[model samples]
Target: MIGIVYITAGSMENASEIARELVVRRLAACVNMFPTFSIYRWEEKVEEQNEIVLLVKTDSSRLDEIIGTVKHLHTYSLPAIEFWEVKGEEEYLDWVHVNSS
Candidate 1:
């Protein structure tokens, strides 16, 4: 199992849209969305804003397909998408593998 983190705009509508697509397509076992704050510079202008963060759980082998789909569907030209290798207790990992598969 693998845990993927994605940062999207603060819009619930956008988060919901992404969540639905990933889950329905079986690319993700579960997606957890929570509020987050982001500070960055764009187009030579600095900006600070609240954002929605998504924690997507899926099988490790499916990461590429999922990423490709996101790149194709994401509104932003360079969406912040990353994956964290989940190295933890065996039981939890097993559960994630089961659920994602």
Candidate 2:
């Protein structure tokens, strides 16, 4: 199966660094990052901030390693990380599995 991991970072540099690490370690096949704004409750107060989002594509088998690497490399004390199984083109999914492996 395929998996997509969603993560948010404080800055473009941070996001890029995390993406690079994941790709280099073969934990992710590819990472797409973009700037976004987030509004959420933290410390019992609503907070809004500009952030970078990373969309990580990989094989489901690598999900645990991806999460561990992100936690080790992420700057935030509590980074936003989520993952879900997905379906996609067969060829593309095969490529993801090959690269992640």
Q: Using lDDT as the measure, which candidate wins?
A: 2
CA lDDT of each candidate? 0.76, 0.92
What are the per-residue Cα lDDT tens digits for candidate 2 across 1-101? 78889999999999999999999999889999999999999999999999999999988888889889999989999998898788988999999999987
TM-score of 2: 0.96
lDDT tens per residue, model 1, 27-91: 88788998888899988999898878888877788788778877777767877888887777787
Question: Ten residues in a row with the worst lDDT in model 2?
Answer: 58-67
lDDT (C-alpha) at residue 28 in model 1: 81
Clashes of 1: 0
Clashing pairs in 2: none
